[model samples]
Target: MSAQKVLKLSDLKQDAAVRVVIDDIPIAVVLDSNGEVHAIGDTCTHGDISLSDGFVEGETLECWAHGSAFSLRTGRPLNLPAYEPVPVYEVTIDGDDILIDPHVTKEVN
Candidate 1:
């Protein structure tokens, strides 16, 4: 499972977010407040809402389903109703393309 696809770049805008699926995993690639591209699981652990549709603040992706925010880097659930952490994927920028590792480990602490 070493397939990689270019999604977007980091020189675009501050509120830029892209939703992509790789290796059958849904991921939301977003540029955080630190101007770094981060990848997180699209599904919210609190419910079944897509995190891509939620608000992304800093490195934490807020789940609109239950307001459960998860860290884009560590995938740690930071809100209520979602004690479980979502998955975070590795992101690499190739020129202007954002490559996301879809098969991320679901280990959250």
Candidate 2:
């Protein structure tokens, strides 16, 4: 499947996260502190919480419920309370739009 245009680049502010649904999957589109964009699974692995409601520290998104930190790039859980990694989607920046492919993910190692 092709990448779907999820959001406009201008709508996403720095150090903020937005929840978007594509292909029935909930995704969290984040603009980190370094001005880089990332797309990760919105659901926190440890708890039934939205990661977009959590905090963004650098490249990691912390779960608001249990404080599990997930890597934005690899989707690997960095902290405790969550051992499983969430899905990380491939993000494509097209002009002023943010495109995301839910089928593609960065390999977690």
Candidate 3:
């Protein structure tokens, strides 16, 4: 599927996460303090909670309910309670637009 414009780059705040649903696929869009944009699955593997409602620490998004931190780059859980890694979508920055394809995800090693 082609990438869809989810939000404007200026719409994101540094070190925070926003929830966006594209084609019924929920995703968490984050703009780190380093000024890099990342897209990952919004659901917490440990619980039925929105990762976007959680905290952003460095390159990880911590689940508010279980305190499981998921990597923004790889979507891997950095801590316990969540061994499953979430999907990480590739983010395309076109000027101020943030594009993402929900069907396309980055290969994490």
Candidate 4:
């Protein structure tokens, strides 16, 4: 499927993560303090917890359960207990809308 509108940019709070599901895929959409938008897999690789429920630290999203921080850009875990990186999706902005395609992810290697 092509890119779909997940939410409006205005609806997002700065440095906060908003969880959106597209095609049964859970994604965490974040509007960082730098006024940049990011989209990553909502599920934490270390635990099955939702990353949206975690805290946003700079450009990283910290999992609330185990304190594992995942990079908003590369989706790599920067802490212990989460050696695996999550998927990072490409974000598109049109007017006030944020679009994300679940199947499309940025190369992390």
- Residue range 76-102, candidate 4, lDDT tens digits: 999989999999999999999999999
Model 1 clash pairs are 8-98
- Model 2, span 65-101: residue lDDT tens: 8899999989999989999999988889999999999
Best-fitting candidate, scored by TM-score: 3
Candidate 3 residue 10 Cα shift, in angstroms, is 0.6
Model 3 agreement with the true structure over 35-107: per-residue lDDT tens digits: 9999999999989799999999899999999899999999999989999999999999999999999999999
Off by over 4 Å in 3: none
Error of 4 at 63 (Å): 0.3
lDDT of each model, Cα atoms only?
0.75, 0.92, 0.96, 0.96
Is candidate 1 or 4 superior in TM-score? 4
Off by over 4 Å in 1: 10-12, 104-109
Better of 2 and 3 by lDDT: 3
Q: If ranked by lDDT, best first, what sequence of candidates would result? A: 3, 4, 2, 1
RMSD of each: 2.3, 0.9, 0.5, 0.6
Q: Return the TM-score for candidate 4, rounded to 2 decimals.
A: 0.98
What shift in Å separates residue 84 of candidate 3 from its native position after superposition? Answer: 0.3
